[model samples]
Target: MPTPSYPPKPSPGDRIAVVSPSSGLPGLFPRPYELGLARLREEFGLEPVEYPATRRMGATPQERADDLHAAFADPEVKAVVASIGGDDQITVLPLLDRELLRSCPKPFFGWSDNTNLLAFLYDCGVVGYHGGSVMCELGRPGAMHPMTAESLRAALFTSGPYELRPAERWNDVDRDWADPATFESEPRSRPGGGWSWINADRVVEGRSWGGNLEILSWLLMADRAIARDESAYDGGVLILETSEELPGATEVFRILRCMGERGLLRRFPALLTARAKSWSFERPNNPQQAARYAADQRAAVERALRAYAPDTMAVFDVDFGHTDPQLVIPYGGTVRVDGPARRITVTY
Candidate 1:
């Protein structure tokens, strides 16, 4: 495959497409969706253009693909962002027109299930973004996290190397988006312990490859996004993070092991394991339980690495996945993991 190039950045006044290529949670909870749209206009100074499937829950794959095609094909649309991510986005992958998107590459930002789209864009030779969902990040309860807002602003407008900073205060817990009371106050967060580096011996620079762990597992099962030639990932940084579903440590280990079995795990020399999302509305884990969850997840990762990529350098708890104060990572773009300096930088 050819080297992936960064898509053009959008100006403040430019229009952006906000579509729900996956799940349309905006229909179920309009509060955050509207608030997110307002922020896009007021704070970002960008007009958010929503497609028909943007707020329509249970939109079929064809409808979502049509919205994506329309969004990318429109000259007025300078960027494309997801309203939110949900399951079943893998179904939409088959319907996308590679040549159409390649003809008009735009910065696409979304995480969680949107991993499918990012990976797809990478293979299409266009760089996408791995964060900044509308309802979750922009419409975050109370106010946007300072770190998140700053990182997103830079990615949206600028194109250059940007150093990533670990969040001083991070949140794993989430409030009910459906409840009006959830919007009255900010979600709770805890003091961050910063990132922990393992095998911090050398710096590694390469494009990023990987996303929400569970989502990637699904893609692997479907034989989607991931390169058939394992060498396509050679020297690239592997990024992995779990979502709010709170899959157990054993599950994490099993998935990585499967990748290793396929000769895909040891290709990347470095790994950036996102801070695990510990608390969820379904499983309101206490502080102690949350800590255990994080610890076990880390242990599982270590166990898998020892068996597969034993020499790979790893940095755990980087705030970029399902965590609050999410950082924007450049999908298919350059990432410099400076193990010796204990810093991570990405090309925006």
Candidate 2:
């Protein structure tokens, strides 16, 4: 596979394509979507161009692919950003025009279900930005977290090495987007206890890989995105994080087991796992329940490591994925995981 390269950065006044390759949550919840667009203009000084499917719910894979094609092929569209993430983005992957996308590479920014698109861009030799969604970040209630805003700004406009700092305060809890009152204040967060490290005796630096754990499991099952030979991922930093669906600890272990069995688990010399999102509207976990869930998830990860990548260094809760105050990671870009200094940096 060809090495992924960073696409050209968009200037402040350039246009950005706000395409919905996934679900059109923006149509259902226009409050946040509109706010996000406003911020893109006011704060970032970039014009957001919405595609036909951008606000259409129940858009088919073909429709989504068309939007993506138009977005990337348009010279005026400097970058492409997802309105929000959804479950079926994987279905749209097969419909994408690889040659077109390869010829007109753009920096794509999104996380969660949009991992599908990022994975596709990786194979196209383009570096994508993970963890900068419209509804979630730009439309954040009250205001964008200082750290998140800063990290995103750096990722979007700059091309250099950026050091990632652990969030001083972090959260996975969210309020109802439909409720008008939910926009009145920032989501609650707890004081961060620094990231937990296992086997922090060595430094690992290489191109980064991995995404939402559940999405990756699905990709592996569908024979999508992941390289044909696991060695394509060797030496790369592995990033894994769970979503708000809150899959059980047993499920998490099983997924890793499958990857390990496929010889994919030991490719990475280092792993950076996000803080688990234990609380969701479906299951509103209390403080104690949240703690137990986190513990179990971490333990499951450790168990998988012991069984398959015992020598891999891991750091948990480095402030990305499914969490508030997220930091943008450059997908397929260079990552430096320095265990001795407990510092993680990414090249944007």
Q: Compare the candidates by lDDT and give the number of the best one.
A: 1
lDDT of 1 by residue, 1-348 (tens): 667898888999999999999998999999999999999999999999999999998889999999999999999999999999998899999999999999899999999999999999988899999999999999999989889999999999998999998888988878778889999988877899999998999999998999999999999999997776769889999999899999999999999999999888799999999999988889999999999999999999999999999999999999899999999999999999999899999999
lDDT of 1 at 112: 92
TM-scores of the models, in the given order? Answer: 0.99, 0.99
Q: List runs of model 2 lying over 4 Å from the truth.
A: none
lDDT tens digits, residues 135-192, model 2? 9999999999999999999999999999999888888888889999999998888998
Clashing residue pairs found in predicted model 2: none
